[model samples]
Target: MNILVTGGAGYVGSKLVPKLLEKGFHVRVLDWFLFDDNIFKDLKTDKLELIKGDLRNSSIIKKCMQGIDIVIHLGCLSNDPSCDLDEELTKSINLDAGINIIKEAKKNKVTRFINASSASVYGIKDENNVTESSKLEPITLYAKYKADLEEFLHSQASEDFSPVSLRPATVCGYAPRLRLDLTVNILTYHAVTNNKIVVYGGEQKRPNIHIDDLVNIYLLLIDAPKEKIHNQVFNAGFQNYKVIEIANLIKSVLGPDKIKIQITEDNDHRSYHISSEKIKNTFNFSSQFDIKDAVLDLAKAFENDLVKNPNDSKYRNVKHILENEDFINNKILG
Candidate 1:
């Protein structure tokens, strides 16, 4: 099967694209190469095709849909701060461009369309666990767009076209295109590089998944029967941890004495625990890696110098967008 992975050079996509190729699926990547153009440079596979273009361009998106059997749509201005940086650009990419991709996929006779949604769509839930059917309370522009796209995807699902939305947890662990902005990753980076980390409003709970497990869930969806997942929404989260708990985990992994944790107060209180029981009960799928495992993996990566500069703005999406005025004007605005 020929699969098209939009944003295939991104944090999760860098890990996922190679796995799809290993599974013998001919993969084509559509991305603007905003972060790192050489993310897949060492993947010596004939089944890989790279298209360096933005998803907002209808012409580029149409060209990407050619001969595509499955569409793994992961392209967007991912995360809250990044989306907040430019709401117009975020809507253009995450909502408008996403709709264009789905419409083109249906037109091109694509069998499966898997959307990479976020658990943040269930923003600031109460003490109860948020399921797929729970009321969506998107607090950020990013989460709102994902929720909108999820609704739009359900509307587009048909007998011939199967659309599945996977509301994935905040992904942790190392990827080829490494990201340091995520909670676990940022804490780990500070523990390794600075020997200290700060926890702001550390009691807020957040759902998390190992990057590998998150990638595997997408793989499973590719092989799952259409009848089972068609027009269905599933949350793909494994573990839930408070911000302080995650900081402690990093401290334990790197060495308690080697790292210092300082708790601070912050007004940003976005917290939610998602339940993946529906997907587990229906498809027999569950995450294998836990928070400790993810922490260790990142620690090993830092120790091996795999991630040379974790403090670089390029590794942090929000920082990169904020600092680079030209990127905002030329790449995002244009």
Candidate 2:
């Protein structure tokens, strides 16, 4: 199978593209190549195609969709902060540009359109087990865009065109292109580097999944029966924990004595939990790695100097977003 993974050099994509290659699929990575420019630089493979282009360009979208069997649409202003940087830019890339990719993919007869949606679309849920059938109350512009695109993708689904949406939780773990901005990662990074973990409100509960498990689900979707996945939306979050629990988990993994926890008084209301039972029942998939694994994986990666300096600007999404405002608004948007 031939696959086109948009934003294929990113944190999840960096881990996924290589696996796709191992499975004997001809992989094409269409990316802006800004954040992870060094990720796939040394790869010398005949089966991989790397195209550095903006997704907003219709020509680029059409070009990438050419012989693609599956389109893993991971490209976008990924997080709430990144999208909130500029509403127009976020909508342009996340919503408008994404539509272009789907149009071209459907036009070119791509079998599967696996959208990388966010579980954040559920917002601050009071219910314990928020399933895929729950109403979407997107709290941020980033999530609103995801909900909007999911609407368009489902409407576009047809007999030959299978558009599946995976509303994934906050992913955590160590990847080739590691991110320190996530809850688990940043906490672990602080524990490893600063010997401290700070929590504003320790009671907030957030759903999470290991990067490995997330990648495996992508592979499963690639090979799933069309009937099972056509226009299906699956919630992909397994682990649920409070902010303090995550901080303490990091403390346990990376020297509890050395890592100190400082909890400040604040009402941090950003808590969300989701049920993955539907996906589990559907794909016969279960998570092997948990919060401990994510912490240990990141700890090991830092110990081996794999992520030599987690403090680097490239490792933080918000850092890059703030620094490149002009470039993103002009060049990337254009």
Candidate 3:
């Protein structure tokens, strides 16, 4: 089967495309390749095809939609900060482009549409366990678009089109296109490199999942029966903890003496504890790794000199976008 993965050079996609290739499926990755154009350079596979282009380009998206049995939609200006760059641009890049992709997938008769939605959609939930049934009160433009995309995808679902949206928690752990901006990765990188973690508004409870488990979830969706995932949304998160708790956990795992937690006050109060019961009960899918494992994996990667400078702009989505204004205007936005 031919699988078209949007944002295939991203943190999750870099890992997922390889696994798809291993499974004997032809993988076509459509991405802008902003982080690293050569992320898949080492992959010498006949089943893998890489198309470096903007998602906004209808012609490029049209090319990607062809011969695609499954559409793994992971491309977007991720996180709240990244989308906060320009309100109009962010909407165009993420929401508008996303809708176009959904329409194209429908027209192309794609069998499965596996979307990577954000748990942030359930913004600042007072409820203990924010399930899939919970109302989405998106606090950011980035999150609002995710909720909108899920709605659009479900609306497009038909007999042949089985669209499943997984509102994943803040993803943690290492990937070829490693990200240091996330909660787990941020704390772990600072602790390992600077021997200190500076947490802003450290009390917000956040849900997270390991990158490996998230990739596995995508793989499972491909083989899962249409009846099981059809027009369904699942919360793909396991570990739920306060920001300081995660910092302390990392400190404990990485040796308490090696790390010190310095908490600072900030108004970034977006927090929620998501329940993965829907995925577990419905599809028998559960995350095998937690934040502790994510911390250890990132630490090991750092120790092995895999990440020279974790603070590099390339490791961050918003930072990279901010630093490359020229590229954003000429290449990415165009």
Candidate 4:
């Protein structure tokens, strides 16, 4: 099968693209290469095609849709803070650009159109586990757009066009293109480098999944029967942990004596415990990696110097965009 993974050089995509190649799928990547493109250097096999361009470009989107059987749309502004930076830009890329991709994919006869949505679309929920059918309460601009896209895709789903929306948890663990901005990852980084973990709103519950498991879910979707996945929205997540609980796990992994935990007030109060039972029951899909495994995976990455500078803004999505405002502004506005 030939697959097009938009934002294929990103945190999850960097790891997923290679796996897709190993499975003997022809993979084409559409990315701006805002971060390093070198993540694909080692895996640049004959089956992999990397295209550097913005998703807002129609010509590029059309080029990417050519000869594509499946379109795994992972391209977007990503996190809440990053989308908050520019609402207009976020709407263009996340919502408008996504609509274009879906339209082209359906027009070109693509079999599967898997969208990367976020569990943050649930916003602040009660202690009960939220399912895919739960009411969506997107608080942030980022999640609001994700929810909007999901609704639009659902409306467009048909017998020919299989659109699957995955509301993934906060992805944690090390990827080829590492991101230290996530809760588990950021805490692990600070614990290793600064000997302290700054945690905000210890009581806020955040759903998390290992990066590998998150990628695996996408792979599963590729092989899943059309009847099972078509027009279905699944909340993909493994475990739910409070902010302080994640810090404790990191301390446990890196040694409690070596790491100190500090609590701070956080402005962002969005929290929800997502349920993955529907997907698991339907497809028999369950995550293999746990939270501790993710912590240890990150620890090993730091030990090997794969993450030399965890403090670098490039490793953090919001920080990187904020630092390169002028460059990003030109790409979006112009």
Which window of 10 residues has the lowest lDDT sum in candidate 2?
A: 325-334
TM-score of 4: 0.96
Candidate 3 residues lying further than 4 Å off, grouped into runs, are 268-270, 330-334
Candidate 1's clash total is 0
In model 2, which runs have C-alpha deviations exceeding 4 angstroms?
A: 332-334
- Check candidate 3 and list the clashing pairs: none
Error of 1 at 245 (Å): 1.0
TM-scores for every predicted model: 0.97, 0.97, 0.96, 0.96
Model 1 residue 109 CA deviation (Å) reads 0.4
Cα error, residue 105 of model 1, in Å, equals 0.6
* Candidate 2 lDDT over residue span 1-334, tens digit each: 8999998988999999999998999999998876877797666789999998988889878888888899999988888878887788889889999988998999999999999999998989899999999999998999999999999999999989999999999999999998888999989888888899998888999899999999999999999999889999999989889999999888987887878999988867667789999999998999988889999998899999999566677888767877876646556532
Which whole-number lDDT from 0 to 100 does residue 66 have in model 1?
Answer: 93
TM-score computed on alpha carbons, candidate 1:
0.97
Candidate 2 lDDT score relative to the true structure:
0.90
**Displacement of the residue 119 alpha carbon in candidate 2, Å:** 0.3
